[model samples]
Target: EPIVEEMRRFLDKGMELQRLVPFAEVMAELAWLGEGDRDEALHLIALAEGLAPTRAVFGGLAAWRRLLSPESDPGETDGMAEPHRLQLIGDWRAAAALWARMGAPFERALALLQGDEAAQREALDIFEALGARPVAQHVRGLLRQSGVSGIARGPRQATRANQAGLTQRQMEVLQLIERGFSNKKIAAHMAISPKTVDHHVSAVLGKLEAVSRGEAAAAARASGLV
Candidate 1:
C-alpha cells in the first residue's frame, strides 16, 4: 500500500510537469495497476494515447494489453525506445547518491529529470549537515529504487527545540539579525528608528526565549520561520 501511494505521488508529480506525458502516463498506469484496477489502467492508457501520440504510449498500452490478454503480440515489449532510453541514460548514479543523502526519492528524481543535480546535491548536503537523518534515510531508499547510489552519510540526528512565537515586527528584526545587520543598519533598512529596532529586537528575543540575537536567528531557521 505504501508503494502504491508512493507511485501515485510520483505519477502526480510527473503529470504536473505536463511536458513529460510519456513518463507521466507510464507512472499513472503503474499506479492503477499497483492498486489492482485493470479497468482504470486501460483507461489511463487510452488517455495517454490521446495526450501523447508516441511510441512510449503505444509500448505502455501494449504492455497493458498483454497483461489483460496473455496471448498478445510479444513484439509490444520491445524495451524502452530511443528517446525514452536517452532520457533515462543520464547521471542516475549521482541523482541516486544525492537523493540518498537528502532522504527524498521523489524530490531527487524530479531534480534529476529537470537536470538540477547541483541544487539537489546542495539540498542533500544541507539536510545532512543539519542532522536530518530520517529525511536522509527516506531519500536514500528512494534513491536506491531510482537506481542512484554511493551517497555519503553524515550526522544521524539533531535535537530541534520548540520555538516561541514572534509578531511580524519581531520576525522582521530577526531576519535583519541573520543578515548580520547592526541595529542601526536594520533601522535604516526598515525605515524605523534605532530605538524602535532595539525594542523590536528585545521583544523578539523575549518571545523566542533566547538570551542572544544569534540564538533567535538560529531558532527561526530551524523552525522554518524565516
Candidate 2:
C-alpha cells in the first residue's frame, strides 16, 4: 500500500498548496481508489471546482462519477475528456478501443460491457480471466437481461478444475474450429478483429497441445472440451 500512502501525502500537499487542478485530481483518485464515499468525493470535487469555476479541471473525474453512478444522467458527458466522454455517453465501443490503446485492460473490458451481446460476452471472459468475480457477475446479469442464452450462472471455476485455462472467448474459438470455421470466419462471426481471432486461435491450439487447427479441434472433441 505504499502507493496509496504516497497518494495520501500528495493529496495533503495539494490541499496545503491550494492547487486547484492537482487537488481535484488527487481527490478524484482517492474517491475511486480509496474508501471515500460517492457523496464525499462529489463534495470534494465541487470544492475544487469552486476554486476555479471556469476551468475544466475535473471534467474527466465528473464524467467518471456519472459513468459509475447509476442515478447520474448518462448524457451529461458534454465537454468531458475523450475516453471518459465516450464512456459516460454510452459510446462504449469507442471507449473500449481508446482504453485498449491506453493499455487499460480493466477499463476496456468495462466499456465493452455496454456494447452488444458479443462485446458483453468478451467483457465477461476478460473479467473472469482477471478474477474479477463481482464485475463478471454484473456482466452476466447484463447478458441475462439482454436475453443472451447459455450464460454461466455461478462464479468462475478454479484453475485446477479447468486445467487448460482457456478463457471463454478462446473456448468459443475452439468450438468454431471444431465446426470447421476458419479464423477469418470466426472473427466475422464473433464481431472481433481478425488479429484478435488469430490470438484466440493460437491460444486454443497451445492449450490443446496441437500444432494445427485441425489437430486442436480433434483434441478438443476427444477431450470433451468443445
Candidate 3:
C-alpha cells in the first residue's frame, strides 16, 4: 500500500515532467504486483494505456496487460495477441521468439517458462544471470510446483555488447571509434559512405548519452562494450 502510494507520487512527478514512459513502466510493475487482483490490475492497465503512445510499443507491456482483462478482444491488437494465444495453447516457444524480437525480456522469459522443460530451465538461467533474484526465485518455484529439477547454475554472464540499445552497425562503428578510427576510416572498413558512418556515430553517441565520440568510446571500453 505504501509502495503504491509512493508510485502514485512518482507518476505525478513524471506527468509534471511530461515524461510518460515512467508512468507506463510503473503501471506495468503495479500490474505485475497485483497479479490476481484483477480490478486493481485493470485500473493500472488503463492508466498505462493512457500514457502509452499506442496500444503497442512499450514493447509487450500493453499486450501483457490486455491478457489480464476479463473481456478480451483478439481483434483489438490487430493480430498482436497471436503470441499470447500461442502461449495459452502451450506453444510458448513460438511466442518466445516474438517477445524476443519485440525486446520484451519479461514476456520472453514467461513464454520460455511454458515452452518446455529445457526452455523453463533457460528462463530461470536468464533470470539468475541478470541477478533478477525475485524473478529467478519465481521461476524456480514454478519448476518445483511442476516437479521439475536439475537446473544447472552456470556462470552468470549477460552479454553487455550493444547493451546501450545500439544496432549492429552502430556497435561496429562504436568498436572502430574505440580503436581510435575516424569517420572516413570507419566508412572504408564498413564499405559505407562517410555520411552514413557519421549518422551512425551520432546515433551511437546519443544512445550512449555521451557528448563526444571520445567519451562514448571511453564509456564503451569501461563497460566492456567495445
Q: Cα lDDT of all candidates, in order?
A: 0.53, 0.66, 0.64
TM-score of 1: 0.28
Worst 10 residues of 2 by lDDT: 27-36
- Checking candidate 1 for backbone clashes, the offending pairs are 96-148, 100-140, 103-139, 104-139
Which prediction has more favorable TM-score, 1 or 2? 2
Candidate 3, residues 53-120, lDDT tens digits: the string is: 54344335444554455245423453336677566545678889988888877778878876678998
Q: State which candidate, 2 or 3, has the greater TM-score.
A: 2
Query: Weakest 10 consecutive residues, lDDT, candidate 1?
Result: 156-165
TM per candidate comes to: 0.28, 0.45, 0.44
Off by over 4 Å in 2: 1-36, 48-56, 71-79, 137-150, 153-226
Model 1 misplacement above 4 A = 1-163
Candidate 3 regions with alpha-carbon error over 4 angstroms:
1-7, 10-24, 30-39, 47-54, 57-59, 66-75, 79-91, 98-107, 149-226
Q: Clashing residue pairs in candidate 2, if any?
A: none
Q: By TM-score, how accurate is candidate 3?
A: 0.44
Clashes of 2: 0
lDDT of 1 by residue, 1-226 (tens): 2343455557766653243344434544433223234555555555565665445545434444443444644242235443223224444455445555767654343334324445445556655556544344444544566666676654432322212434455667788898889999998898766755766677677656689989988877877767
Ranking by TM-score: 2, 3, 1
